[model samples]
Every structure is written in C-alpha cells, then in structure tokens.
Target: MSFTQQLHQAAQNIWQKSLVHPFITELQSGQLPLTKFRFYLLQDRYYLVEFSKFHHLLAEQAGNPQIKKFLLQSEADLRACEWSVRSDFFTGLKITPMEIRQTAVAPTAYNYVNHMYLTLERDGFAPAIAAIVPCYWLYQEIGQKLAKVGSPVALYQTWIDTYDSDWYEVNVTHILQLINILASQATATDRQMMQTAFIRSSYYELQFWQMAYAKERW
Candidate 1:
C-alpha cells in the first residue's frame, strides 16, 4: 500500500481499537460533567501556546515546502484556539490568566508532546512527521465523526471547531500529501523506519490524551 493508505489504515485501527472511541462515547453520553469539561478547556488553553511554538519550530525545519506552509498555518490555528479559550476564561468563566497559568499541568502528557518535538528536531522531518501523524489523523477522524452525528453538545462543538478548523484540515491534507511524496523517494529501510516512528508516535499520542484526561479528573 501507499504511505498515505498505510497511515490512514493505521489511524482507522486506532480509532476503532483505542480510547478515542470510548472518550467520544463518554462525551456523547454527557458523562464527563460540566466541571470536568471546563477544567479540560482551561488546561488545553494554556497548553496550546506551547504546542503552537513546537509546531512553529517544526514547520521551520520541515523539508517539504508544502508541509512547512501547513505547519505555519497550524500555528495560526493554535493561536486562535488559545485566544478563544482565553477570552472564554475571562468573559465566560470569569477566570484570570494567572489562574489558567497556575493550573497544574500533567507533566507526563506535556512531556510526551515535547519529546515528539525534540524527536522531530533531532531525528529529521520524516520521523517528525511520523511522530506527529497520530494527532492530525485522530483529530481528522474525530471531527468527521462528530460532524456526522450532528450533536449539539458544547464539548462536541469545541472538539469539532478546533479539529475541523480550515487551518487544521489544510495541514492534515498537506502532511498526508507530503508523506506520499516522501514515501515514493524513500528506500525500503527508510520506509520501514518512518512507519515505525509513525506507529510509536501514534501510541504516544494516545497516551498523551489518556494522561490529560486522567490529570484533569484529579
């Protein structure tokens, strides 16, 4: 199979077999409670700034022009999300920026993302792309599912809005296309290495979410 097909298949497997489906089911069932949801939003609000910085660095180092452009675009999207969350905090929740900053972050979860960025910077763009694939793929999948269900939940809207934002979608598509192009130019060893990195990154992505959910619950 082509690299795109392989990556898509891997993502499909993750969606079906992993915690993502269960988490979405929980959201659909309204089991997370408003308090937990609010906490999650606040936590993510702070993290987006760091995440955006990481992506900005990655985009600068990306070998493919298209991928670099997409990364730059994603930085903008992350910033917008950060702004939205901050606005909601002050106006909607009456929370202060200091409170948001002082909120306890899940170290393991944040570290994993940081590690991915470091890996990308150290290992090379192909592996970095591989490492980050799960986030993009998972977001795309979740967005599509939520959009299909047409749910009215605020959390659903949040997820869909953030993941399905034009910038996110464009980056996802660009990354997939770049992977295909790179795959064609790669040797068998390179392909295997990239695939291995991609799969490991996906697992880390799963862990990141699981850790975030667990930390917020605490």
Candidate 2:
C-alpha cells in the first residue's frame, strides 16, 4: 500500500466521524442553518489565509524541483479558491470583508493552522505535508460523496461542487503521490512523525465541523 493509503487507514475512524458529523449531514440534507454556514465561512476564510501561507513556506523548504513547483502552484490555487469561496458565499450571504476582519478566529481553526506551522518547525517537510494533505483529501472525498446525494440548497451544492471537480481530484492525487515518494525515502522516525501529523490533521478536520455546528467562540 502507498504511504498515504496507510495514513488514510490509520485515520479512517476520525475521517468517518467527520463524514457523519451532524454539521456535514445537516448541510447534505439542506437543513443546516445559514447562520451556521456563515459562521463557518468566516472561520474558513481565516483558515485558508494561513493555509495559503503554509503552502508557500513549505514550497520554500522543498528540495525537489517538482515538489516545489507543485507547492507553489497549490498555494496559488488555494488563494484563488479562498477568494472564490468568499465571492460566492460571502456575497450570497451578504457577509462583508469588514465583518470577517472583525471576527476572531475560532479555536479549532486557530489550533489547526498552528499545528501545521509547528509540525513544519519541529519535524520539517514530510510531516508538514502529511499535516496538510487531509484538508485536500477529505474535502474531495466529502465533495464526491455529497455530490452523489447533493444538497437541495444551491449554496451547499455549490460548495460541494467546488471540491468534486476532476481538477481538484488531480491536485489531490498529486499530493498523495508526493506523500508516497517522501515516505519511501523517509527515516523510520520521520515516517512515524508523518503518520502522527496525518492523524492529528484528520482529527482537526472533525473538530472543524463541530466548531461550525456550534459556531464556537473563544
């Protein structure tokens, strides 16, 4: 099995919880409150801002030219995606940049972004890649599944469609391949750090949903 496949297996339980989380299920059913989704969008805007920076930082550290190029491209894509989400949902919901700026980052998103930064600081590239991959993988997985059972709400369906596209899948596959390549050359200790980073990121994925559902503060 590929290294990412093993990481997926190890984190399957956490991923499953995220899939079945009430926040997700409610969104799927088109029963999720707009207030909750708006809160989510705001916090997500914060997360994606830092997430793009994380990619740029990772790209700087990448020794492989291919990987560095991919990371830089991914950073651009992430910035565009973040803006697209903001344009679509924020305008649709009448959320303002002022409001988003005024809002504080929720704990889940703050911790999740910090976790990625800390992983890079302490463990370097491989583990940092592992930490970020769940954001890509889980969204595509959720989007594909939710596309099959699409939301009646156009907004929710639009969100699902964003991740469900073939282009998004290709980007995700590229990163997973990178993971496998890194794992092949990684020391046993580095591999274990990667595994731990993957699991923690997966767990954070689950918490992000809960935070949205509760519109968590502080």
Error of 1 at 77 (Å): 3.5
Please list the residue runs of candidate 1 whose C-alpha ends up more than 4 Å from where it truly belongs after superposition. Answer: 18-21, 63-67, 81-91, 164-167, 216-218
- For model 2, the superposed segments whose C-alpha errors exceed 4 Å read none
RMSD of each: 3.1, 0.9
Instruction: List per-prediction Cα lDDT, in the order shown.
Output: 0.66, 0.92
Candidate 2 matches the true fold with a TM-score of: 0.98
What is the Cα-based lDDT of residue 192 in candidate 1?
A: 72
What does candidate 1 score on TM? 0.79
Taking all chains together, each candidate's TM-score versus the true structure is 0.79, 0.98
The digit string of per-residue lDDT tens for model 1 on 1-218 reads 87878866765565565445445666655565555555656656655666677788888877768768878877786567646755764556566767777877666556656767777656666766677667676767776766655446764566566665676677688778777887888887777767777777666656555554565433
Model 1 error, position 138 (Å): 1.0
